[model samples]
Structure formats: C-alpha cells, structure tokens
Target: MHDGAVDLKAEARARIYAQPIEMLDPAQPELFATDAMWPIFERLRAEDPVHWVEAPDYGGYWSITGWNDIMAVDSNHQTFSSADGITLQSLESKAETARRGARPSFISMDPPRHDEQRKTVSPVVAPSNLTVMAPVIRERAGQILDGLPIGEEFDWVEHVSKELTAMTLATLFDFPQEERRLLPHWSDMITNAPGHGPVESWEHKRREIDAMVARFTQMWNDRVNAPPAGDLISMLAHGESTRNMDKAEYAGNLGLLIIGGNDTTRNTISGSVYALNKNPGQYRRLREDPSLIPSMVSETIRWQTPLAHMARTATADCELGGKTIKAGDRVVMWYVSGNRDASMVEDPDSYLIERARPRQHMSFGFGIHRCVGNRLAELQLTIIWEEIMKRFPSIDLVAEPDRTHSIFVKGYESLPVMIPSRN
Candidate 1:
C-alpha cells in the first residue's frame, strides 16, 4: 500500500469504530481506494443494517447493508425506483451532466421503456449468442496471454485486464481492432470525476466525452445508412425500439453499455489474480482441478463485488428493515456489503473456489435491473483462466494494486505482476 494512503486508511478505520453509530459513513471514495471500507460495512451489518447518512453535498442517502434488505429494495421496483439515477451522484453532478445535454440511460429508466431498450441489445448476450461468442473469446484470450512477457514485472491491469477488455468491447461494437484501447479509455473517463480515477479535471473529462460523442455519432450515421449487422451500434441503429432515439438518449445508452462492458469484467480479471495470489492454497487447488475454473469465477465476482452499489429513489413511502422510507429518498443497495453478509453466504470473506453453490450471491444484482451481460462476463473469466492454467504455472503479484478512488467502481487502476517462465 502507498504509505500516505495507508495512513489515511488506518485513521479512517480507527475513526469509524470510535465515532457514534449514526455518524458512521462508508461512502467515502478514499476508504474504497485504500481497501478500508470492510470494517465499516461489518459494523453496519451488525449494528444498523439500514443506516442513513446526512451528507448534503454527496446527496444524503440511506444505505441498505444487509442481504435481505438489499434484495427487498432491488426487487420491489414499484417502491424503489431507478429513474432518478443508478449510483449516488451529487445533485450538482446531475445538473452539470444535464447542462451538457446528457440523458438517462436505460439503467436509469423505469418499466416499459427500460424493458424495451434493454431487450434491443440483449440478443448479443443470449444463450445462443454466447455459444457463438465462446470460441471467439477463447481465441482472443489465448492471443492476449501468448503476448505476455515472461520473467518481467508488468502492470497486469494495463497489459492483460484492460487489453482483453478493450478487445472484447471492440468486437462487440465492431470498432477498429488496432484502436480498441479507446473503449476502456472512454469508460474510465465516464466513470470518474475530476481528480479521481483516470480523469484529471472537468475540462479533461469534457474533452474526452466530446471526442466520444463525435466518433460515435459518425458511426451511427454510417450504420444507419447501411444494412443492419451484428454489432451493438448497428443494433441500436436498426432495432425497432432504439431506431428513433434522439441524440442525447443515444449517448446515454452508449455510456451505459461502454462502462458496463468495460469495468465489471476488467476489474474481476485483476481481482481474480490478486485473490489467488493472496490465497495460495486455493490457487493450488485450482491448479489441481481445472474444472474449478467456473466455480472460481463466480466466487471471485462475489469476493470482488465490482460496481459496489446501485442507487434507487423511493417512489412511495415504504417500510424496510423496520425503517420508514419517505418518497423520493435516495436508497443505495450496497451490493458489496450484501455479497459478504454472513447471514446469507457461508464464510463470505474467504476466497473459496469449490463451494457448493458459488453463484448464490448478489454480485450481478437482482430483479429487473440485474446485470444483462452477466453470462458473457462469466464466459470471459472462465476462458481466460482456462487459458492461463494451460500456459503458465503462476503469475505472481509483485506489488499491491492501485485501487480506483471511487466508491461506485470497485476496481484497480494498476496491478503489478510477473509471469516467471511460461510452461
């Protein structure tokens, strides 16, 4: 860990325990960046599963920390609505984005509209589609692994995680293969605020968004003029539901698809490597039985809990966990907390690869807004690990990863590792 960050994290951990129960707030980006949010969540789950924080600047919100509570909010879409926004964004950020002509993506929409828009592109990841994509993904994973440098330390987040992410996203969008890196770059910009993640400033983020708008607009026109094809952009251009969407709506959905496609799989790739390195016994078990790859993939998703929380607004007064929630209150279901809720998951903290039911977790969420690309994400992880076990004996972590400075994206910005001699 970086000394300065470690010091800050230590202080935060100490403060969390010492502070009044009502004063505990686990939404700080700094805590997530330093990997110190665990204790806060632990205390909340034990003391107050449904906790409320009063931070006007960050948007005062209720944090639902227990497994059942999160499911209640996620499933009761009538009471807890996603129309307001998906993550906990400050009031100002929403206004600023609106001023920039950005609109809500399908993830932020409710009912009929959300269902229609989501279905338009859902075919790409359908069971039949996944069957077609499996071999293509494996071939690409092999190429990515075969290109790795042995006996040298490199940022795996950059060379492997993001590289493979960009390639898969490139194929999904039918973007130029050589310039595939732009997909992850654009994702980073969209997810970050000024002084956080990969974004340097508001101006920097604005420029990147503008560039994305221009390029995607050009592609939209090109695809609209031509016949429909297999790519996502083309699907949007020709699909009955999405064909008539305005520019702002088009941009919003693109942001959803791009970030969703990039972050979850990318973070989990890095997380799997880090988790295995931390638990050598599980790594040995994995090596002994390659069939454990699928189970290991699901377990890592639970352990990592990428994309920590999804926010909802209360549509009506409701009772949850014995607390009365008023209309229009910001309700955040902390999936990261729920995934590790011992009440639901047995030995939730341990990185166990061969559990009886590894997929029984809330990492992909629940109800209507459940992650649409979950199957594809699992396929990628399974294929990559299968490839890794076939080629290298081990890829050791050389140093601690630099985590993302955002509570919303539980991801790494950099991970150092070495492939000590390929098999």
Candidate 2:
C-alpha cells in the first residue's frame, strides 16, 4: 500500500489516465515501426481501445485503438472534428507563437463550411469521373512497364511506383509532365513524419511547402485567364466555388491533392511488389488467375494501410469506452489497429487475396473522410499489376526492404526488386 495511493488497480488506471499523449514526432519515421509500438497497439486494442498518449512536447491526444472505436469516432464527426487539423497538430499549432496562418482546406474544416468546401471538388472525384480517367491511367502504366530495366536491379519505389503515380496525377491535374516531380517533393515536405526523413524542423519545411503553395497561386491565376478543358485545375479555376477560393485555400487544396495522390497510391504499388515477392503462395495465386488483381489490390491496402492514422479534435467533453475525453482534446483514429481487429477481420494478420468480403478493410478510411481518390488508387494498382503480369510472371525482391518509420503514411523507403526480362 503506497502512501496516498488508491487501490492498485485504481492507481494503475489513474496513472494511465493521467499520462500525457505520446507525441509521434513528424521528424522521425522509425517511432511507428518499433517492435515496442506494435505490441503496445495489440494490448491497447485488447484492453484499452481508447488509450491516452502522454506527449508533453507535442501535447497530448487520445489514441482510438480498435476497429469499432475508430469507426465510432469517424462516423460522429460532429464530436470528433477535423477542422482543427488532420494530424495531431496543424502547421499553425506546431509553429512558434510568432508564426501561424489560417487553415488551408476542407480536409480540416467542419460542418456547413466543410460541406460547402467539399462540394466544390466532389464531382471531379466521383465514380463516373474515375471511369473516364481509367484509360489514361492504364496507358501510362503500360509505358512505365515498357521502360523498366530488363534484367537489372532497380528501385521499384522510385522508378515504377513514384513515377507512375506522379505522371498519372499530373495527367489528372493537367500539369506539365516535366514538373511532375515537384508533386512528390512538396508532399514529402508537407507530411514529413517527424524523425522519418531529412526534414529537421517543421517551420523550415512549412516555408518550403508555402512556397509550393505560391506556385499553385500562379497556376490558379494563369488558369483563370485561360483554363484548360477536362482538367481539375481548369474546373477549379472556372467553377463556381473553387473559383472563389482565396489564394491560400486554393493552394492548400492543391497541396492536399498532390499529397493524397502521390504518396498513398505510389506506396501501395511499391508495397504490393514487396508483398508478392515475400508471399510466394499468394503471389502464385494472383499470377495464375489475373482476375485476382482487384482482390490483390484490396489485400495490399490492408497489409500496408498507408496513412496509418488521422486525428480529430473533440468538440465537447464526453465519455468513450468508460473514459472521459475533454473538449478540444485531440483524438487519433488508428486505422492500422482497426484493420487488424480480430472481430472485424478473420485471421487479421494473414494476407489473403481471396479473402471473403475483401473490400472491408479501413485502408481508405470510413464514413465522410473516406478517400475521394479511392477508385483512382484502385485503378492505378490494378493497372500496374496487369502490366506486371503481362511483362514478367515473377518479381524477386533482392534487398531486405525497409519501411518508413511513420505513424502515418506506411510504406517502403527502399524496395529493390529483380524483374526478369522477357527480352
């Protein structure tokens, strides 16, 4: 009996409750990949589905660790708001007191304003629009596969995945192909997981991201004068709502699109190659039956779950899973843990292309914030696999692949693969 302590169980609960949030530094990517982190997630999901992470440096936040709890948080967006910022803290929140600006887009907006802003670009991402874009995505995939080095080891992450998604996004936005590389570069800087890459300070990288936003401003101005037809920029430039977006908002939305398209889809492709190479039986099943490409795509999303978690702010004090969440408290919905929920997924750890109800995974999220580009991402992966199957029946991963140490945006930093040349 420790002095002034409640019963042991109550004391332990109090300690856990009093704990500050575990700040996931955007500067390091390894924190998310630590073996310690994985087991913690497992325990959190089983015992405390909504655990508090005590991160004094980055401020604290609630960690929504289970499948049902995450969906509950996502579905009730009025309570768990996105308007504060999508991640743990907005660029403004992370900045020194002297710096901070108005937010950028609907990804972080709430209610009527969020609805209004979202409607501006919704049509462009609708299913019908994706169908129209399929041929364009497929054409680029074929060209990329043809250009691969026939019998040499190459970084599939850079050459195949990044290049393909970048070009496709450029086509979607009608941006110049030569400047396509800028999309990934700016995206990396904007969402640099603390301790993941070369980004040292948020303020420094934010300035770079702001500069990129300025470039979008110029593009918006140019498009307003002479907009290109059948392109997102043209639509935004001349449309009713997007046309009215201020320079900052316009730039932020554009940044959002680039980040959404470049990293998530590209990583899935790179991860798919790695998954197939490592899981020979699953690979053979797909290689033998080309139809499994769709299911294979779903499996890849489950296995990778790019962009692991997105945070929201609690609008009011409330109780969740017998725990209290104060108003303005940040709530992080961990999709990585949700996908592995035993109740939701059968044998959650295994990768099965033919798994029944293959589309149930939370890779693209659920409810309102579900990825608008879901169809496009699926198209990219399916096309890449199609081309891969046609060109080479087997791809051997030559290097021990490395994962990005990121709590958000899960994928490979380097994936070396040996593709046999039919030539």
Top-lDDT structure, candidate number: 1
Model 1 clash pairs are none
C-alpha lDDT score of every prediction, in listed order: 0.91, 0.77
**lDDT tens digits by residue: candidate 1, 196-220:** 7678887898899889978999999
Task: Residues 215-311, candidate 2: write the lDDT tens digits.
Answer: 8777777888994566777777887756788876776687778878888998899889878876889999997899999999998898778888898
Off by over 4 Å in 2: 1-28, 33-36, 90-93, 96-102, 193-204
What lDDT does candidate 2 reach at residue 213? 77
Off by over 4 Å in 1: 1-11
Worst 10 residues of 1 by lDDT: 90-99
Poorest 10 consecutive residues by lDDT, candidate 2:
20-29
Cα error, residue 164 of model 1, in Å, equals 0.9
Could you estimate the TM-score for every candidate? 0.97, 0.88
For model 2 the TM-score comes to: 0.88
User: What's the distance in Å from true for residue 60, model 1?
Assistant: 1.0
